[model samples]
Target: MTYFVTLEGETYEEARESFSWDVPDGFNAAVDLVRKHDDGDRVALHQAFPDGRRERYSFDDLDRRSSAVANALESLGLAFGDRVAVVVPQKPANVLTHLACWKLGAVSLPLSVLFGTDALRYRLTDSEARIAVVDVSQWETIREVAPDCPDLEAVLVVDGEPEIEGGTVGDASVSRFETAIDWRDDDHEVAETDVDTPAIVMYTSGSTGKPKGVLHTHGVWLGHCPAFSMYFERDLEGTYWTPADWAWIGALGDLVFPAWHYGQPVVGFPMGSFDPETAFELLAEFDVTGSFLPPTAIRMLMDVDDPADRYELSLRAICSGGEPLTPEILEWAEAELEGTVVNELYGQTEANLLVTNCREWFPAKAGSMGKPVPGHEVAVLDPETGERVGAGEVGEIAVRRDDDPVVFAEYWNDPEKTAAATLERGDGDGQRTGVRSESDGMPEGQAWHLTGDLAERDAEGYLWFKSRDDDLIITSGYRVGPREVEEAILEHPSVAQVGVVGVADDRRGKIIKAVVQPAAGTAGSEELREEIRELVRDRLADYEYPRAIEFREELPQTTTGKIRRSELE
Candidate 1:
């Protein structure tokens, strides 16, 4: 049976064999994937704004705009390996800038528009980015901090007139992006880039301190399209929508690049905000076949009074990532959205979509992350010994890098941190017996990337997510998973959202604190907090119950919808 799940078709695997991963040597994604595969006539990007404005870009148009941006960068004397920081909201100009960087073989650093001036400076300095392409609205923030960044040479403003300010030292140049694109030539050649060459440097959300720049190569990203296409069972002919920002790997690889590679039309809602009603309208309007939304968005959509009445979902499959999809959200989507199966994919910026539950493989266990993708090996290992854990046992989620083609190379400019993250145990006697190791270990070539996530594997080889290693809340020698506590709190109808964190306590060493966003119009009170604590105690272990509850309007979340537990803590 073909493994394809269609509105009308065979199983997905049978249909998937037609499309395979066969990246050519010195392949630049802009030239090889987007331009060559999509060609000139196919619509590549359809961007809709909340203000009723819409723009469409064909593959040829994307190619031309990107080339223009590349030529403009070259005119500024930026070359291969030079870092270019892009600080724009989810918009067409952001997409153009990213592709343009790929054309010039420059490393693109995509920064979150929500970040303040200090956060921007940290990334710029850390990557040593030479130029920054920023939206005009954010120009003041960048301008305020640009003086402190000695390495920054140019600031190109998108959608704003350039006004040079006084005391701007060095050869710092300012130009309107529209004027800069005039230097673009239709036939500008794409520079040759090695497969292992760094294409993007994505910064992790720095909850602890400064964010680390995770470097991904052309080879890594090139493999992403094939893997995602296979997992989602996306046809090269269908439309795909991933409601995320360009700053995130989920949006960049899973939505934009992969869809482009498959010669599929991609849709972007670039109003720089997410509303369930608007999202539902777009899905109906575009007749999107495949789509992705965070679990939170799914919940919001579920809360809509009459989703079926409001939207016509031609969507064959929908997936959620960035955070685990709750069972409540899953059931809601199935019932309200024409019985569409909501598959969950588990991955991070460090590694994109490592394990994904296929739409055809529905009824997946709640909180399970599914099996590892083909060509990738996933294991649950004892955090200290690095020994593979037995079935139904929770351990650190580790990926064998030797066979995983999608694994990232290193953290840019931070070799020590990279070594720590990518290095694992080797097959050696005594201390290393039956242990998984890094490339520096196993006979000079094998390595494994340590996924900081903690998970468990059942007897059937289904992987179940537990919590991030750092996210595990320990109180009085009890190992409590925040997700379990959060899940229990979510059982309450009044609890719209919650984040559990361990707070330092004098008596218990640490205590569980649940920061909750109550359902709209629900009043917060001491009685409610006590009620929630008792409810958790009934559902979970005694230690897992949150001792205190703090009410908030909404829980802090990353752009991709993962709750910012660190921020809550």
Candidate 2:
């Protein structure tokens, strides 16, 4: 029950050395962690609705309700290893469904509520989700895509009765969340599963190509403890909240799971979309102590003048990820939210947060992506030679396979892609190597997992993110990352936001193009564009400046707030 272990040591080095983790062979997260350590009568989930309504669920309540859900699934004939798609907003039902899946040893796939019919169909078919536990509003999209997903057995609608056309969902059955758990027994036993057992399958946006299902095992849950503990400074009785949807790892892995794993209560607000005013009201109303805010959301909040004067915020530390946290945004947040440190964190769905600006341990670095998290070996490597790059040299970000447990098992059912993701030690140099496996313990040499993202390490050992590997721009035999250009252009007072991309050119092979969204009161003019270009030219090399600038009211962005550079390209 006392899973909340406080990390000791005054310096980051001492903390990293003192950190330790030991997870049992067969670990059932819901049963072993939540149920075993029940902080009786304490609020485990505090949810706020957009209509000014609120609800609370205790730790014991979630445990029992989740068991009821597990029993209900069993009654409906769903068994272990089955895929259950969860497509709902941040609600008590979302946590209930995930815990139920864990109890039944089923694989849970969380799909974003903002996803379109096509995106929904792609995931449902790709992950082969058998049962979809979705919101009533999203039922129509599921109905349309049900015919394409042959494995879809039924759709469990939450928040309302299932209004199926002719009372049927094609061959797939339809049921309500309340009805499913109404008569079901609230005492389902946690299924026996090993640490390596498949627990969840999350899909990437696949902006580059078809979405790939990233699978993580039950054991990876252990890795989040020390990683999040070091970053968020897990407080047992403190209130926590995340504005991100339950679908993304930023919300699920970084906040929800970690909070539950470390015996901390979390606030869930299903506002549907981001709203600065509502966010301020909820945080102050709930007295939230800590949170993780993405860069995109931070940008929107920056517009709110003097946030501290508007509401009293209880935030001690704030973490950001997903996109780069510009210095402007950081400075604004720290100033607006008094006494709060807006620290930036770095990681992907493939592996959870690998690097972070641990504000509790070290001061915040404005634009740097901090140092590699303890237990995970992260480095910027030369892609061709698989050699570690020197300071200030841009290279592919790779995680060294050394006693690290957070690395994913495989890209669900794609062995070709799995092998491609791994780099053999000195294989490119034609060196003979023996067969070494992850199961046989840590093997020596330069073997690593390719992250496919480009970054450079500064002299301080802090990694500075650049751009995606495929997104790299090469013009006239010179290399350029859109981030550097975008950062420079963003420095202009008239420029509000910008997305840079490489466009096809007959002469230079590829030319740098800047898509900018000007600030209010500032018009997109040739004169203003020239001024922006002049700012960039003075800051960066002449060739690195954007050759062309296109102004828009807003840049194309995904639901998660990442800019869609592919659309611009």
Candidate 3:
């Protein structure tokens, strides 16, 4: 039952027979998958620092270190299911802490290291985290905010001295992670937890309002790895790199879990800054076989003047997600990179990759999101009527949840929000409704997780993406999706990258405003704006073209490579 398909041009299949998981009552990802399945000598992680320092950890090293961390947490009397907030940059300690939590069956809440005292306090307070693992650099900031987070019991510093400040419970209780694991005779057994129990609380990218914690179970997360391996046909012995934070599910799904399950070594470069050349060098030096990045990073590499000569990319497969893959970028990768296939997948934090286009399926339809992965059913339905849409017609993209085990359990502590996303009826339409009735053996709303993204299913069963439902701009009585306009503008040779958003317009309600980052040495002017508008006019409908274009040096992007559209709007 393993699914196989060509992405870009190469064909691959999953090692697992099926995507289904019979969760064995109580499941622990770290123990069952990492400890039990992994060979002790296999390199689990290789971390390189910006200062030219490097550290490697084998599965045995990870197991022992994580066991010590588990013991330390237990010694502090923090039991299973207690929340532990971690605010550290990408590093070995960060990864180890997560593995430690998984071993203890404690929920790991990874926070962005960029957060100041105010932002950090919010997540700590919201999750009611009892322990905080923070970077030494941010220790002062954490100290400032720790008093406000009454639930915070201890602070584990990663790269500096553990000084116990006064006025905190039990003298600030800090532990330094620079030392090797002092494994004691204490047999730190992995906790037995229900498969449905919360394993990780991943916060949404927060493009709209406050970030919501999307709760996922062990079964759901583990189910994703096999699907990923099947999709990529990843070599079990090859090296993989995903320049994504573990906080994001994309990293967890595509990099961590699969690599661990198959015993492949993974490289994690965790600096706060991104250097395209350095990234390229890393790929070349490591002989990375498979790598995944956001389209933004790919575009950045493409924008480099001498990419082919500068870096020797021995990559077998190059995967991009977090946003739509532009045809221009795809074309560039094919031309410049030797025999590398670009794989694009469509997924969200709520679910791992539901649909993907492989490298063997190269020369794919320019705008299509490809076919649904086997074992899942995908449909395009009218948002209001819930009727399945005809080919090429835009509607909400809904995936059938009947047999899909990778779907999230629920939103953490937000039953009302969960109900809104999962329980709503499909307008009582027989054809469009994924749920038959409450008694039909399907949960009322859980029958389908309404992916707020809008798209169209082509005659070939391939899904063509449109835009997010909230991102549709209504201007001058005309509705427009920013993606269409951005795609149109991107056709202009002078435009390096463009972000389209709805700016306030009294006459038009909300006119299309495009922020463009021009090609090198290109000047921004009214003429350039008009030229972009004309290009859009040629490709898109008259109403969908950008009326106003603002030039920018760069555009903001998320860790997953999606444009921060909320930042622009």
Candidate 4:
């Protein structure tokens, strides 16, 4: 077997002790991982379209097609370090774009196809991308925004041309993807890049502030080998799928990169509006063995009646991320979806998945984020003093950087923000510690990466998520996280989804406010509000319960499906 990381022992403790990422510099995704592990004849991607169309691409097909794309891009005058912004959906072209970028040492920036013209323009301008690869259906957005993005030099349509006038971006050229790669050779020399060379730049959704570009390097891709092995039980013989856009890091990092690195085929679909029935059909039809869905998607599926009896699911492992998973959803999944526990994964766009409740290694508890995966040192620290907090104490969740080979290189061109996010050891000044011998395997550093999220560690070492540091609620003298209150309210039989925020109050400083979307056929009333408040009070502390509840049919969300809590205020 090709050398890939795997569990070496029976328990989580032993697995952690054995885990290591012996990553080296000059790692190229196209040459190092894919070309090395992929057997030419095996399927690499299986794309199932909604209109009853399906296509499969073997590893050899991707290798040749991506090389053609690289040659085509180079012919267009694109060079190393050039940013190629891609606004395509979950099609095969999307995967090809990333692989082609790696071959040229160019940085690929994936923008959500759901982003509006304004959002699209902001990212294009911020990243200063020279070229854009977009779908024909979304050409209007590009045309409207391209005029404002002076840095964008050309546009490459994925399938065909759109019915629009030309000269959109100051005479910027437009061509179809198929036409560009038509005559190109099926092979190109992969660029030799150092571990620190920027490979990709992903932007935050700007739920709080202006979107910031998170830059990652080629070596970080190598780190995913151990991160996946420690937290995920890979089934080389099984199919993989994630119900998220390839633009999101969750799908790209969790599903695409690691799966291909270990030589496994992945399922892809153009995500329009998500329908539970269609999702069920795909899972059954494909006989998917491993998959992941967001918490919101799971909540919607739970409303479907008798899913277990309706569909024959072949799922062996189920996982979730993007938000905390509620106990109610987990119970439903275990009962209806092949008796598999939904593992809750935790991480940010800056740092891929750092923690998980990996069922293969450890048993899970309700509402906990589980332990830090091997190769990461995660702890709760005092935000003020930067000291490690004791059990049951609430503080910022941080990861020590010394041992992490995958921590992001930097926030794109923002040194001050990067410095602010880095944490010092204890109360001491941030400085370099002496390098440890290879036997210890620790890097030379005295700083930790502050995650900017609040959490607490239990006596058993499980980490309970609280809220984003800015999202912490301060009512009177007590601090509360909205997730804790939201989790309790979601357990109500009448609630479908909930978002908790801190509303201004003169006496208490800030009062707990719950904005809820009631379950179908359930009417929202004062009586139901009181019942939810009572439920929270019983499940959590008295002060933690919401003082006010406002009902809504649906909450505003970003393109990636995270709730827009700031907009609610």
Question: Which candidate has the top score in lDDT?
Answer: 4
> Across residues 180-200, which tens digit of lDDT does each residue of candidate 1 receive?
677447557888886677888
Worst 10 residues of 1 by lDDT: 1-10
TM-score of each: 0.91, 0.94, 0.89, 0.94
Candidate 3 is scored at a TM of 0.89
Q: lDDT tens digits, residues 188-276, model 2? A: 87898866788889887665566789988876666655667656653435778889989977788877887776667888988877898
The order of the candidates by TM-score, greatest first, is: 4, 2, 1, 3
Superposition TM-score, candidate 4 onto the true structure: 0.94
In candidate 4, position 230 carries an lDDT of: 44
Residue ranges of candidate 3 with Cα displaced over 4 Å: 1-19, 162-172, 179-181, 184-187, 234-236, 305-310, 361-363, 424-446, 558-561
Runs in model 2 lying further than 4 Å from the true structure: 1-6, 162-166, 233-237, 401-403, 426-447
lDDT per residue for candidate 3 within 132-178, as digits (tens), equals 88887777888788778878888777886645432353324666655
Model 3, clash count?
17
What lDDT does each candidate get?
0.75, 0.78, 0.71, 0.79
Q: Could you tell me how far off, in angstroms, the CA of residue 476 lies in candidate 3 after the best superposition?
A: 3.2
Mark the regions of model 4 whose C-alpha exceeds 4 Å error after superposition. 1-3, 162-168, 234-236, 425-444
Give the alpha carbon lDDT tens digit for every residue of 161-272 in model 4: 4443233455468877777675449898889886678899988767667788999887666565555654456444677788888897878887677788778888998868
Candidate ordering by lDDT (highest first):
4, 2, 1, 3
